[model samples]
Target: MDEDTPRLLADTNPLPETIDARLAQQLTFLIEIDRLKTVLRQSPLAAADRRENDAEHSWHLGLMVAILAEYADENVDIGHTIELVLIHDLVEIYAGDTPLYDAGKGLDQREREAAAAGTLFGLLPADQAARFRALWDEFEARQTPEARFAKAVDRLQPLLLNWMARGGTWRTPGVTADDIRARKAVIGDASAALWAAGQELIDEGERRGWSRPGSASIT
Candidate 1:
């Protein structure tokens, strides 16, 4: 189910009889975010034949942070960075996945996602809601070392998927190798080491015809 907007629906099961009000609010938010699993992305699963969902993408980022922390330019708190990646895209439950190569949609991407953050995070108890919203804001700001690394991992993961899937979104018409670099190069913000490797991967993708060639009008 490719849901564009998150449905505001109640779960089939009733809340537990002994649950406190705060717990119920928290549980409601948890249940609501289950929709994230249904929101499909553009990147194909390297092992599977279908596109992975938002929840899967976040989980992959957590693991990637663990595996690749050593390569970050700064000595980051790995756990905090993992939290940023995991929390970063929960707003997509409402906003939906914006494809990296989709330039037109990217124009309003921040506004769409900020509204989503407001609606989704507001589901939690007031205090928790504020905290989660702050975390999401932090991820978006990319000011701290952890946020920068998290963003890098976020971009780097999709690049790996596209390469593994033999030009996944790179195969999209009009999305040239330069287009790939222009977007994915944000990886350099956190890790010059990773970006160096990623640039080679992009170049190879173009050389092998995995990515489209020529400056086609993407906008």
Candidate 2:
């Protein structure tokens, strides 16, 4: 070896310990998702006056996936769909929830959600980041069968809560039947079965006097 080579080696420092890329990626998913437990300032639970936290919402949807998988159309991939459901609400950790009756608020909804998606999903390592973002994007785009079904499950949650809680959080806002139906129609593309289930809930709400036939429950 040349004397210059020895000098160059002396000048260099040892590289920092490298982490296993795969393990790093896996651990990212295990990382405690932060800023994800804030209760929506305006949104409420079905039967209660208090607003539910994003973590509660996400967990509720995850349970729906386990219990309602058979209701999904096209032999849905339950595991991936559950992952999608779990992360879908993560953006709310940053952007906050926009209620359906809050007209004109959606103007910046896409931009805010996209930014939140980047920040939250980027917490994971490269490949896992890509995977998480793809799941979120698919739900936003409402394009794939899995995404469609995930979206359906997403919509079903608030409705079930509002209906069962007998004027839960949704009752206070005076949300209307039309508003609920329109927001939930996106689910029809994924599963007519789930949509039918939603319709049944609406009918039951009206029949039980939880809500009016057409008007919001509060009014």
Candidate 3:
């Protein structure tokens, strides 16, 4: 090394291959996000217009958080919850969205979704893939408050659609209020206020002849 020259040092220990792998994984997420824009599915209510696909669902829920964060029972990181909601339904791309009431035809939806998650999220680079998989798992478990809030928003969307559609698509293939309530009661734990509003919608539906009254019963 020359005395008056600037010394050149090397980054001898560069970031490992995992760094590139993780970047690739994140790219896959971006690609999958774009791809989901094309796959449309019906809501639980079976609306004729065809419910928005997974990407739209995610975007809508993100907006929901922005609009409804004040309604959350406890302080929540809206950004994290929004991330959970956005990714939560991606498994449906491979497994298909199984309506809660029509679980009959599928080969065990839970098992199928688990498999789908493995493959879909696995497309990411290893580290990024693992991070997203954890997020997806957290959302599915509904254990943490953020996950619970995300799940509540998930259930709330369909109910609002059903109510607005004037008893529209929910009448499909023998779906009843019992089925809807059973599928959505987890929301009660997430946000009791939201769940109460849902119950009121159910009650109002029954009173207005929009849905079957007292159908939330187990009988």
Looking at candidate 2, what is the lDDT of residue 13? 44
lDDT of 2 by residue, 77-147 (tens): 88888888998888776677877656667678889888877776665777778988998998888777778
Query: Which parts of model 2 have CA positions greater than 4 angstroms off?
Result: 1-32, 41-49, 169-174, 212-219
Q: What is the C-alpha lDDT profile of model 3 across 9-128, one tens digit per residue?
A: 112333345657556456545655565676565652334556667777777888987788777777889999989988888887776777655557454888877877887777677777
Clashing pairs in 2: 45-169, 46-168, 47-168
lDDT of each: 0.89, 0.70, 0.72
Error of 2 at 22 (Å): 8.4
User: Which runs in model 1 stand beyond 4 Å of their true positions?
Assistant: 1-11, 215-219
What TM-score, over all chains together, does every model reach?
0.93, 0.76, 0.79
lDDT value, residue 214 of candidate 3: 41
Specify the poorest-scoring 10-residue window by lDDT in model 2. Answer: 1-10
TM-score winner: 1
Sliding window of 10 residues with minimal summed lDDT for model 3: 4-13
Q: Supply the TM-score for candidate 3.
A: 0.79
Ranking by lDDT: 1, 3, 2
Please give, for residues 52-73, the per-residue lDDT of candidate 1 as tens digits.
9999999999999999999999
